[model samples]
Target: MMSNPEKTDLKNLTLPMLERFLQGRGKERFRATQIFKWIYQHDAGSFGEMTNISKDLRTELAETARISKLEPEAVEQGSDGTRKYLFSLGDGNAVESVLIPIEGRNTVCISSQAGCAMGCEFCLTGTFKLVRNLTTAEIVNQIMAIRCDVRAAGEEIRNIVLMGMGEPLHNLDNVIPAIQIMIDGNGLQLSNRRVTVSTCGLVPEMERLGRELPNVNLAVSLNATTDELRDRIMPVNRKYPLKELLRACREFPLPGRRKVTFEYVMMGGINDSLEDAKRLLRLTSDIPGKINLIPFNEHEGCGFRAPTQAAIDAFHTFLIDRNVTVITRDSRGADISAACGQLKGNLENRKEII
Candidate 1:
């Protein structure tokens, strides 16, 4: 079916926004809650599927609103059970998401934009440049589409991470509401702890996110300990240096035992030195969070190489010796170009050549 640009996407609205929308349409605020449950909980494809709602009201909704859904244009599954999904945005642009299944947890990584503007030298998505920020529906539907697959396999998606193709903080306007829908008790019913928003140190937005969604987990893609190196790898660091970024992390309100996760991507011969490890400890000493040491996932055209197992072990050992909680994450879906945006980059290049 052709998309109706004029029609409002009900999936785009948060609970409060939905309430306002219904009220404006001369409907009771309760109608918004019912619609929310029908769309999210019941996965209603159309207003006609909402049997509990009156036929007249359903007809009214059908005339002006549409439930947006994204069907993946392509899906690549790795031997490790990690699946990468490429979804068309209806425009010329497309975005990708990944499903990572661990022992007890099934995490779906969703994207916030068609491509990335943050030119992190190591990231594949940044090579494409920024296409556009995804709408609320586009972001939310990625989770919904993946959740459908996980549930069919008799496993539920326990975690949602905005660590796919784009910087979530860069698209805060759409990302925030999408997150609200994720943790809403009446809808998706995901625990606040299960959802994570990862950013390459967008300082002001980080503070704003902590203020607005204190319960939701925050992860900073802190690939370097020193600003000099970080600025070279992640261009965003040039705007908001380590001092400003770390200050935001330190000041971020952590309700309960929540600590801001520091995601350090350890590149071989780059930021993997013993000196860098020492600087990392000093940088995050006061922050009440753990460290996730990710060995650089080597990809084509990227000169960066993954740190050796010996180097990774040394980095992990140093942190453990200093009473820091750290976990060296094994890179998943290596055979399937599971690194964020790798599959999309390959597909787009093929299309150009074709």
Candidate 2:
């Protein structure tokens, strides 16, 4: 049987906080940095591996602080080099994160909530009820686990997308701190430019994110072109309509050459019409933006199918013809139910609390 006591997840604690904790325990400040470096930079899984620290200090840390690790219950790899990991948290609550390797960059999709509250009609995650927002440590552990895997494979993760399970803006308190930890040079060391936070048009949080975290990339999941359609598809739109959301995007204070990425998932015969494409072009005309046209990735209970290649191509061309910079995102890990909005976690199916 495991003899571990309930302790703070050290992987979730920031470097400075760790230092303070050590200082409180009458340990030298440098010991904190060393432990931090070992856990984060060297990927030490246990305090016993922190060799530089004295044996007594190591024992103290072992008893006082806990290093969080994800026990991957299941891992599925797609033919297109996308991998999905179903990680079981300490409380048996499970969450899913994916790693997609494209060209030279690997983008890890991180989840902020166990299940999404945003009831976007076509989303697989939205089909399930929101369980609870993930803690900052839980969110950061997903990235750390993937980073460890990348190192073992002699590769590096170049980007991160908060586009996996939940609406990020809804969990801004935890999400914001998690991003800060990722961007911290002493930790994950990911650049803000490479971390994209995707939202379903949470207007107040959108504006606040722009003002507070200026460097992180922002992406709005704008599935429909008009308010009527948007409201029907995304219930959040009923509160923060298209006009207000777009206005927030336009007024977003982005730095040099950093344009907000607008994610448009194409649903076959639903929002894939040329008229919808034109309206999309018009809606985003004045903002500095790039459109990511994602062909819908279907799930078991979700009744939506991806748009045809021809229809997707038409939508891409329509945006580019109007001088809009567009890229059709290749849906990865779809076969394993790990594509966008498809991560509902195994815990849900098991009827377990997450």
RMSD of each: 1.9, 2.7
Residue-level lDDT for 36 in candidate 2: 76
Model 2 Cα shift for residue 61 (angstroms): 2.2
Off by over 4 Å in 1: 340-347, 350-354
Q: On residues 181-209, what C-alpha lDDT tens digit does candidate 2 reach at each position?
A: 78888778888889999999999999989
Residue 156 Cα positional deviation in candidate 1, in Å, after optimal superposition:
1.1
Give stretches of model 2 more than 4 Å off.
Answer: 1-6, 26-28, 350-354
What digit string (tens of lDDT, one per residue) describes model 1 on residues 242-342?
A: 99999999988878888889999889999998899999999999899899998888887899998999999999999999999999887887787775435
Minimal lDDT window, size 10, model 2: 345-354
Residue 226 displacement (Å), model 2: 1.0
**Which RMSD does model 1 reach against the true structure?**
1.9
